[model samples]
Target: MSDIRPKYKGSLLRPMKALSFLFREPATLPMEPREASEVYRGFHLNDWEKCIGCGTCGEICDNFAIRMVEIPDLPSDPAKGVKARRPAIDYGRCCWCALCVDICPTGSLSMSREYIHVSRDLDSYLILPDEAGMHGENFLKGWAKSETSDLLDLARQAMGELEPEARSDNFDEVTKGFDAQSALLEASRCIQCGMCHEACPAHMHAPEYIRAIWDGDMERAVEEIYRTNPFPQVCGRICTHRCESACSIGRRGDPVAIRWLKRFAMDQVEPQKVQEIALKNKVSKPTGKKVAVIGAGPAGLTAAFDLAKLGHSVCVYEARPEPGGMMRYGIPEYRLPYDRLDADI
Candidate 1:
């Protein structure tokens, strides 16, 4: 076979053409940093003041690059659901997905436009960012949370309740408790952030119970509820739920139905079963100690309950016909049914 391709004819001038560019100006731009895109996913920037230390960012990070570090000097208020911790980012493992910023309930986490960080020290790659950039220099905000970018289910499930006209005729409980389906749907909304647990006065294990409820284990949910609270039925009905206020979801949307979820769990279990669960941890041996509680109100009864559980003999005195203090004598029956209060007592 004959080759049709032509052979190349080399030129002496072509070899010298390469040297012509050396005399001309260089084509490449200067090696200096330039502005990045407005919404570029770059280094992290956290507003420590706005961050509640929910650790949602750490939980959502697929690479496990975010870690919550305790800052001893930072203020912590359990009632407000604030923690003395901050997130530290490991750039080596980060993918710059911006998911941490989108899921942040407080909108305190965002990416900065300045992304360059060149260092020989390995520890410099990991940083606890504040408003300043990676090098402690101010940078423009990059990707951040917006209504369209939020990943949380802000709107909670609608609660079932009796119509005003229907409730006007009788003193029956106006708010109908959640059904199994609605309860599960509502429980799924929780991120298990533990914010509610800190905000609760009893320090109730809300995240544990909510997860149990979502898993469809009514008995386990009930058990978790009774761990810190003895009066589930009463508290579920009328106690002020500070936990809801501290709910991370409530920052952008309606908070989870924590109070109603408690009521639902209590309603699902039998009264006898609830009583058994509540007393499951009571001391088997009597301590032979006798204690007298002045009143049979919530506080006094709680004291008595604790005392009795510790194998101590406790006696409660009540001036009124019933032992519920303001919960019984003050709150209307329509709001809190007497039968429910009795079950709690």
Candidate 2:
């Protein structure tokens, strides 16, 4: 019978076969860094020129990886809602969520395609990113803020008003003002950034009052309104709302109806209640000072209100039958009703 087992013959050339390919070129190409996708969430990039430094990004950061760093050299204009600060990101805690980019009111924050950040220094991980990338290199932007990705409700709640035809005959106010439901909806849109407060000529506590209105506390809203301005009804109806112009939310969408919200709060609370709230902190002891202000316009009345609150004898003199300055005489009755003006006075 033939032997079933095969003869064992070891090849001497097997060990040398592995060395033959060592001199030959590799089949795979050299490993080079590949470009990331267009929308890759990578390192943060901020346009310092466009950034208002509202810190909305830092506030929305769930991981607390962002902080506002004050830069003294940066222009700080509160009336324009610009702060002299910028966001500093701690990459170690950041999850690359791109939420800051989506919620940035000015659309200044974005991510870069270049994500390769290797460093031996621990301080390098926390950086205040600007227009330049991590290494001060110009990189393609990725994961930028788009209309679809914006978290802010840009469109403002439409306010109801009297039709032009319906009010053509009478001198009643044109704007019907915001109702309770509309007021709450409008007030809820405020991010409480205090931009409105800074922008307001009177520096009214708009954020506080708006929050109060959102919380369904009309009295509290009135109290907040009266903290700075003596005439809520007047300003609510006739005064130009510069606060709206400086509103952070207005960067992309219609600004919060600050004027309308103020009107709503004033309308909801009774005049007596507002007076009580306004005078709550008035000085108990009389100052025994006499202040006589000529003209019963807004300016004069405001001065009188302050003087009276300080426990002084205050009197206002007016030439016309009524005193509202341009608010009553110059402005049309359709825009500002006399009754509301009277209530403010």
Candidate 3:
């Protein structure tokens, strides 16, 4: 390497010439509005046909901006998971996080490219979005599900079960039910929107019970189930679960196996264990009130149970030889066993 002294060979004249172009031309953005990138969060677009009016969006709404409104002309059927009630959003409280869209069971709810909304009247702020755009201009979809970004797990875990080969020969139950790890994984997927509870015929405390199951507390889940339904085994297996239909997670993916989960929790512990846990919250002193219950079906028996638990002497008169009314006679023996029904009684 040779040591060299630098000489001032630099020229300022060449750079001064380049600066003259700045005065000649002004900086400008592209004349046409640029299209938003894919998956860009923007305006609202709700597919009314797909929306079942489950009101799940209203429940998960932290802002209480969403309300369930009854539409008289709309169809309502619990079995198919359709409801007459749709959501009316109050933009004043809506944060536009699009959680409602993410949790929508039907994937009918979405945002659009038309982001601007101007209203002189405050009532216009609270509008129910239909197929038409906000300004009646059908803008293309903006925010939508991408391969990389989805709030839900579309695939449900394959529950452990005795395969058809194994179960074909045996009288034993086919499902093994969820293990501790599997139960926790399944429970973690819930958003706690209470759509399951609303959809349940018995209106079981699904969210609370599911939370308990998630926390690995079978006792708590049993207690919660017993609040609405005394026979967890019966409901766990045979009850038509409308809850799964309204499940927000079901929109993009498989709904949580709420019925199976209830069964899993109930089956983990013995019947005696569940009884003991359930009785912990029982009232010690009697109200000394006597009540006559006409039937012993789920409805009558449930009422009787409540009355009996309240310290009222409840005498149930059944027209049939045994209790459990239709549950015993109507439901198949393989589904809800007589032993489980007897345990609840």
Candidate 4:
């Protein structure tokens, strides 16, 4: 065996010496720009026709280069989960991470292969994207969000429920609502897209309340719930969450359990506290106007709740003996517990 190791060698040469040739112009090419490949991530090109103006691009921007500016002339349909707002990008501050493109629910935001630009004013760097490219030319598309690079928790957390054998003889709530930890985990799955708000019949603030639940602020969640929904408990149990259908995450995986999260938040808050929160916005002075609401269902009751709060005398009529028309008579006790439903009313 050799007892001695080879002697080490060291060099004093500078690492930049290898790059000295790169500084020299070895090849000649035209100064005119050329088009890039379909995958090239150059400038932004938005399709106004399909854009919903959700401002999700701004929300997901890590550099804060995008801002949602209100354009009055543009369509603002909150019912469809769109706003009259458009994204104004600051090229000077933009990192071009493409997170905005990835987070866009409508798939309207996309990048163009055109990279060349000439501007005299600094304000020109700040631009509002539209169907046309920056120069109003239809440039080829570049980097875009695909299913391969999605950044959302699409898989929903499984919710517990009573089995048929478990509740066969007894009449009890079928669904076992999320616990504290499970509720927080479920709430964290939300991307705050606000699609749920538009798809909901009452335009409930689902994202806000979901975030509140994630932050462990049940009171805040309940307050946000009261912003639109007068019957949180009832809706949590039986309302057909159309928001889930419109969820951006559902494109790939299961949609977030928005309805279950609502139930969890409402369950956390005391019944008295919920009532107090619901009545907090009640009208102090009654108005002379009178409104008659026929049927004590959710629709009529919601109308009455709004009208009554506006200082108007509102009367609600229902065919059933109880106020909760279909919600009470139609829905079974197993599906929607009567105690929770009564608490909501």
Candidate 5:
């Protein structure tokens, strides 16, 4: 017989691979209420004690699936990183990306394997996640932050500063702020969540402005800052940054130096450039709407700035010789120098 004929000696038993499917469970299970996979991002579990209610999750969520809800009993403290508010996940909108978990400052968020929920009540879909599961059944964690996939840049960019030897000798500004490459790298750490805005007393548009800064549109960012705040110089320097405290990144990593970034952007553009940009938004024709805004503080100045931009005849009367009311008097020159304040005016 030919040697080729012997090579075709097929096994009489045939391959057993096809038989395995009959014994195995299907990957896509029936929708008739079953447990999720070990790593299925089914639902959220939040530790109330660990969550600061900064709402960074809501801000970074591309789907707008999360909201910060007020829980009356929850204590609110900025320094300790606590908020009376807590994140409420809307299952209707959650994409199960687990970005919130990765960005949570306190690492209080996680996903659970137990996933089935059946109810006619739409309200049930909206849950203020706590340590307990959706049905109060604390299940094993599903989608959690993995070392490789965690999005938070825990370490802050080392801000360039005057050397201790050099700094001690003078009253010069200590921080040199970020350069072009540094600012871009640092800004990338931000998740564009408005948690910083919510935490701020002035409610500055941090996300929008930071985005502008990231895009290298310092002029646009300066304009955005001027939208809600007239004292960018003051805020960039001396304001108590509730924004940094509530920063979602701060939960696990160094919060973005939002104040410094703002200062950097303001510093990048010349005063005349800022004035030109500001004038673009100014109503030049004059509406003749006379609005008398009281005080020259951030609130008052912000109001006056808006009114002035809106074509209204606005005059801000201040008791102090300076334009900035409390900021000029209360804040130290070391923190916010008079020159920067003058630039803002």
Candidate 6:
């Protein structure tokens, strides 16, 4: 053996060098709760107002720890794409993968910095999070949806349009309808947040119908659209599309082509079948109450349709000789053909 022990050179000073650190301030951290990093994923904190109760988080939860429970007090407007439900998390099974945070349509769900929880009660781990933290301490946000981790398709599928030369020569439909694949792809982009419902004056069931279209259930989609909107054909073509303006996906990307989806649904169903679906819920018995609508525009017609369904007699008075006020007269022929407008009415 080569005398390895003899190779130590000035090693006696190494032990003394360690003592120098002893005189320096000792590394210490306060036991008190400290703020986590800005992007740290901790406990969930949901904004109930912004949450649409779409239950998408539960679906994406690979651990199956999330469940959508109906909170009856919360608004459950199907027409608006809101369910009377919220996510109840079982933390015992949570991996904190943050999938829910990234996929949230409205970005209402986020994680908080404060994550401490110690209790004998097992139920405490099962929480329905709100704006407050796990203990209502209102901890500052940690992890939240960001551009980097966004799961929604931000870019809209470009709809094809006829060239100006091709369109101007004849008053043909300007935008060619979305093919089956295009419609399905567009429908898949919806996160079902229901912001469109809130923004729509007609409160159309955009999410439900959009999902129906994606699921390949055209008739079901037609039915869902008819729930709130009686003139899908006309609205699909020429409505100002306030719903698209409020779409949650629109915040980060092109709002779901909601108007186009509606158009696609209306186009799939035959005029006769659509007429049958629209009148499916009409009351069989006469209510003896009569309603007089001033115009045949979308607003007045929508009200008349509902009233008629509730067993009330509706009499619509249109100033124009043709019933469709703006849809028939105001909108250009290429945008909404007279035949399509007739089919809608």
Q: Which RMSD values do the candidates have, in order? A: 7.5, 10.2, 8.5, 8.4, 8.3, 11.9
User: Per-residue lDDT of 60-121 in model 1, one digit per residue for the tens?
Assistant: 99999999999999999877778999999999999999999999988999999988887899
Cand. 3 TM to true fold? 0.73
TM-score of each: 0.84, 0.84, 0.73, 0.72, 0.70, 0.68
Error of 3 at 269 (Å): 4.0
**Per-residue alpha-carbon lDDT of candidate 4 for residues 268-321, written as tens digits (9 for 90 to 100):** 988888888888888799889989899998788889988888889988877778
Task: Name the TM-score of candidate 4.
Answer: 0.72
Q: lDDT score, residue 150, model 5?
A: 77
Better of 2 and 3 by TM-score: 2
lDDT scores for all predictions?
0.91, 0.88, 0.78, 0.82, 0.80, 0.85
Candidate scoring better on lDDT of 2 and 5: 2
Best by TM-score: 2
Model 5, poorest ten-residue lDDT window?
1-10
Compared with the true structure, what per-residue lDDT tens digits does model 5 show for residues 236-304?
877778888877677667898898888878888988988876667787699977988778876788788
Task: Write out the backbone clash pairs for model 2.
Answer: none
lDDT of 3 by residue, 61-118 (tens): 8999889889899887764557787788888888878887776667777777766666
The residue pairs in collision within model 4 are 287-311, 295-317
Assess candidate 6 and give its TM-score to the true structure: 0.68
Against the true structure, candidate 1 reaches a TM-score of 0.84
Model 2 worst lDDT window (10 residues):
172-181
Higher-ranked by lDDT: 1 or 2: 1
In candidate 6, what are the lDDT values of residues 117-213, reduced to their tens digit? 8899999999999998899988889999988997888788889899998986788989887999999889889887666877788788888999999
Off by over 4 Å in 4: 1-41, 45-52, 62-64, 67-88, 106-114, 121-143, 146-149, 284-295, 303-321
